[model samples]
Target: MENSKSWVIDPLHSEVLFKIKHLAISTVTGSFRKFDGTIITEKSDFNNAKVSFSIDVKSIDTNQSQRDEHLQNDDFFSSDLYPKINFESTSFTNVSGKNYKMSGNLTMKGVTKNVELDVEYGGSEYSAQGQLKHGFEITGIIDRKQFGVAWNIPIRSGILGLGEDIKLIANIQVSELA
Candidate 1:
């Protein structure tokens, strides 16, 4: 893999967030407390970069301790059995400007499904420490039931307690791995 240079994800400089509609009136935003990722690219523009990412289900936090515990149970992530959620890139399609579409397989709760992530190249810069750094913003949407986390509540208002589709967003920063 000499042609490809691997970049390590700077977890401290990155963010993994998700949002879903709650009660059909409000939106709930949450973030994973633990995750890691890496990018491998041979070209400087990252047109064909290979991406891999993982998020710890046990680290999911939605503010309320009760809610967090519930998410970690069988109703949702089931962190005890499948503690990690992973994504591996299959292809990258560049659109106009810095926009791109990344197709990959996302595995969650022991189930894997194809997903497409919207990626935006944020350019690159040299850190004060003289390390080469790259930035990217990625977003995607997925159905909770598709991953075997099909827990829903029907309300009297003819609405579900939570939305089926979850929006995922990530602001990633990486440094060239020496």
Candidate 2:
């Protein structure tokens, strides 16, 4: 049976941020403005909860119009061809201490790869608006090359314009649906 305590993602209160190495020294951070997700709590155990999310590729933002436009081009995300990045949870395993491992299939740039996220639950409580809210913070890393984002321009001093690894961090706020 499905869990009774279900939570709908509050997009207004949630964010999906990513950071990538620039020139092997500095970091470039950006986020997707249009994304949504959901979390379903299991009555038997909260650890058995299920989660899923989707991000719109066109929503990529880096505070610079030109950079953002370049990211959505064919050399990078190719937003016109691959309109979305999706994740579906395959398994949730409790590790030692307060850590948990969430394995899921991440689909991006027409490629699907299995990725593991280190999840930390921030507990649940009732909000002022008379809604039950659950907080979670998840972090993960993905190789940009694995998702077909291997475009790079080599510069002097062994530096490249874009890095191969991308770091993802998500701060999610889920509200129970009545």
Candidate 3:
């Protein structure tokens, strides 16, 4: 790993969001307030970068106290048993121009599954404090059932209480480490 540059996520400048359908009609949005990650690369272009990220399951917030607590229970994340959601990239390939495809293993609730996420590199900039930072927008879709979050209820006429597919959106800023 000689000549590699390391970068760490700036929590203050980053956010992780998720959206899912509720009752097969309304969309419910949520976020993980606590998350951290690292990126290692040999080139400034960031092609083939190694990425590792984790989210604190207990930090899940949907803006509703009761629903948030329910999400932490066995019906969803089971945060007590699985306290974190982890992702380690296998490949980060440039698709075209600033677009990239990031394939990785995502682990949650004692289950691990391979997932591919779309990434848009927003280039880099230097903050007023002179810190070098890179920006990226990431999006992906995953089946909750694949990660052992299969709780659901029928709501008549073939509707479900929650959707199986969840959409993930993240805006991340990582600062270069000296």
Q: Return the TM-score for candidate 3, rounded to 2 decimals.
A: 0.97
Give the alpha carbon lDDT tens digit for every residue of 101-133 in model 2.
Answer: 999899999999999999887777888878878
Best by TM-score: 3
Candidate 2 matches the true fold with a TM-score of 0.93
User: Candidate 1 versus the native: TM-score?
Assistant: 0.96
Cα-lDDT of candidate 2? 0.87
- For model 1, state the Cα shift of residue 149 in Å: 1.2
The worst-scoring run of ten residues by lDDT in candidate 1 lies at 40-49
- Give lDDT tens digits, candidate 3, residues 18-135: 9999988799999999999999998868899999999999999999999999999999999999999999999999989999999999999999999999999999999999999999
Which stretches of candidate 2 lie above 4 Å from their native place? none
All candidates' lDDT scores?
Answer: 0.91, 0.87, 0.96
- Structural similarity to truth (TM-score) of each candidate: 0.96, 0.93, 0.97
Give lDDT: candidate 1, residue 118: 96
Displacement of residue 105 (Cα, Å) in model 2 is 0.2
Superposed Cα deviation of residue 2, candidate 3 (Å): 8.3
lDDT score for residue 101 of model 1: 95
**True-structure RMSD, every candidate:** 1.4, 1.7, 1.2
